[model samples]
Target chain A: MQTSTHANPRALRDIEMALERTKAEIPVLTPMVTAFGPLLAERFRLREAASGWVGPLPVVDAERFSQGVFVLADSGFQDMSAHLSEAAHGLLPIMANSFPAMAQELNTLIAAMDNGALTMDALAAAGFGEAFTVPGVNAETMDFAVAELVRPFVERQAQDLAKLVRDLPWRQTICPICGGTPNMSVLRRIRNDSEFIQAHGGRRFLRCSCCATEWTHKRISCPSCGCEEPDELVVLSDPSRPFERADACHRCKTFLLCLDTGELADIPDPDVAALTMLPLAHQARRQGFVPLAEHPWGGL
Target chain B: MPKAIFIDTTRCTACRGCQVACKEWKNFPAVPTKQRGTHQNPPDLTHYNFKLVRFSEHLEGDVVQWYFFPDQCRHCLEPPCKEASTVDGAIIRDDATGAVIYTEKSSKEDLETVRSACPYNIPRQDPVTKRLVKCDMCIDRVRANLLPMCVKSCAMGAMNFGNREDMLKLAGERLEAVKKEFPKASLLNQDDVSVIYLVADLPAKYHEFAVAGVSGSMTRKQMLARIFAPVRKIGQQVRG
Candidate 1:
């Protein structure tokens, strides 16, 4: 569940591997998971390729970064055509499988991008957070799909520059790389230098909602409002599945679903891991705790 | 502080849910049994049954008073069984939770000596592996921030698990309330053991091994200290 922000080609394999493992581990999710497998694998392929080719994004300003400013929040990933075209090509067919009713609309969107009549940057400016002229696609689905498409470029930039700001404690609830809020929290296993285990992991790392960047966060603090009271933070989990959990903050009435990678047999890709905790997310919402951010498969 | 369990016997309905839950948690198979003409099944702790609810009946004038005691490892504050272990890592006391855990290496130790050292007579050795097996306070569940199986399964609110401080505070609050009805009510050896039981009546009325035996009135730590004094002195002298 602790998918590091390394956009190496192995991720292409890991995403599919995680999907297969998830199918084997929780057969109940196989049908829903099988449908999205190609889309996710293709996304990871773009991300790996972007890691090698896509670059020259703005470098982080250390002064602004220390003051809780995000690297690419203001100056967004420019000239989105290079990254967006291939992402759309790989995604449209897979999108067809999931959205058969919207096949006509999907084709329209596909043609617009292919012929350069419609650009992703133009779509971001005009359509995002507002009603889209592109017919038939729901706002939430559009947002989710756009986020998925743009993720590879953002992630590659974050991966390339992670070492520069690794040690500097931001203490902010959002991702330093893309100024994105966390979709989920992960308790990463901390390995010691020697043979003997110095400590067992409780280290909390928040995985970005947009770019897949992981940043250290206060374990007791609420991601929504930054409440630090231990009493306010309530842990909800199924005893049978100790790996999955939701940390509910009573103060803000918000919860973030979490995966303890230490308990899992394999380190699942972040997107795949969040899908596995669909039940926990439902449980959290049922308890009247709002999720900080939804995964790309928001409606599902 | 280490973890602790507070058992309020006053609230226990003798449902034996805890007993069944312990067996389920350990994944221990059922043993052959015949009706012994009592509600309590598997009457005592065995290799399979680490927890057993004892049903004791007493006649007070014309009234028949029944007391149910859920017996398991006390996980003593300073476990003498740990000192009695001859093999290293056999009887490990987890520093984090103070859980008296018997590992696979426990097979190397003399079962008699280690078992005898425990005031509660809780340790039961496996015939095949020879390792002492008992309630580990479900350390696996505790570490995962889940309630122990016995505590989780209890519907009567008789069992409570938490930090040692919290459990002690709860035991005191429960003891005060129970004392209003049953005057002889007390939290038994709360300081000496992590598993604090609030009994409604005299400790012996519940079980003989309730608060350690009458002959062995001293706490297990004190007894171990007395027995191992000579060995400690010799070791100190040898070091010097």
Candidate 2:
């Protein structure tokens, strides 16, 4: 019996397909993929209807966008809080099931959201403020749940924001839209008639941990700590697992999970791809490096 | 769902790019060979060379026609080779990608029966390791969401790899389109194999083993029983 209820069939099917393929390669990831997959699929379900209810985006100032100022850094973020309470309600129970250790805290957080004692603004502010008093619930647990709740809402808006930023030059390793650090980096396929030569990819794009947004970054530079020295930023990969690797920055003591999409038959769902890259994440973490961004596996 | 490969022979230029790519991907050492009077190097699918571009040129009407058949394991939907195995952990079928894999444990199986059971004559044993080897459908790359080496290396758009339903649909579409020029054009053993070939002419003109004998004694039920017979792998869990 499935613990999570997936309202959207397509979302459930996509994750299932991803899970099957991922399991074929790394049977070791079966447990993690099976556990978190449906939880993420719940987000996919939310995304299906988000476009109708997510409303419109605030117009961007070209100057600020190009100068490293994220879209969410602007004053328009408070308006996104409208859908927060619903997203939190939908995810908390399933997340509690997914993370047994966090279950008690998440259930309490759900009750807080339900009673109107915890407003959307308060949840959103919890991550930013130094002093946050959510009685009995630790700050770290609250922040993680808050980010998860905010994900669907921001992802819906980021779909609209991605097109606007596509032509714009936002080179920061973090997302130009949500300012979230990248959990993964993809080497995009080459342009114009040279695909068969298999030159890997032309540009490096960092995917946002928050809203699933992607922005181009320097292929040589580390997304964390702006480390550009080739020796300091090293790529660790075994020929055995060619698809997934880590770009570890010695200077920052952090790394980014890297995948070359140019070699892949299809661009896999980022979350599913991350599940397969769990071993590489653990490998990097064992070498005394943390992920550039927060992810389920990063903490593990 | 099982995965499949659709090979449209008409689009193939016989560049031998796919053949070389397979060798490189597997890191198989090159074999020394004298010119066999044909472009098909080493003459057949050897233990080291799992893929072969079988060349057959015939004088057709006023033109000298050349047919290139790049051949490998058919990865039969119901592999007779697996059923013929005497050893418990020798031949295995990965249902996920429809790959018929030959493991190191195959050295202990009654090698002759396993080799002869394959209609395509694909299985080859290493003289040293005494283990059977063949194209495992590039299962490693497929698992990693990448195209097979042969399909990835094909520059002429001749080879395609995808889900079984998509390949069947594509094979049907290509057969219909190619039939206009070559009326006898058809898909080879598509129903029984994961690797479906779209031939533009008679199957015999290409190669002797291009298609399986449809009138063979084995019933579909028997094949299904053999296919579903608790297949398992007994070697290193290969990855890309």
Best by TM-score: 2
Expressed as tens digits, the lDDT of each residue in A1-300 for candidate 2 is 000112334456767777777877678888787778767788787776675224465677889888988777855343456666777778888889988888999988888878877877777676344345566677788877776766676677677666666677776777787777788887765433222433435467788887787777778887788888878987888687686789999998998888876567655677787878888888888898988787855566
lDDT winner:
2
TM-scores vs. true structure, each candidate: 0.54, 0.72
Pairs in steric clash, model 2:
A240-B240
Candidate 1 lDDT tens digits, A1-300: 122564444566667877886787679989878877777777777766764325564666777888898777677544455557777778776777776765667777777777766777765543234345555655555665666666666676667656667866587888887688899988876532232322334578998877678888867788899887888888899877887889999999999988886533346787887887888888888888988987766556
Please give the DockQ score of every candidate, comma-separated: 0.02, 0.22
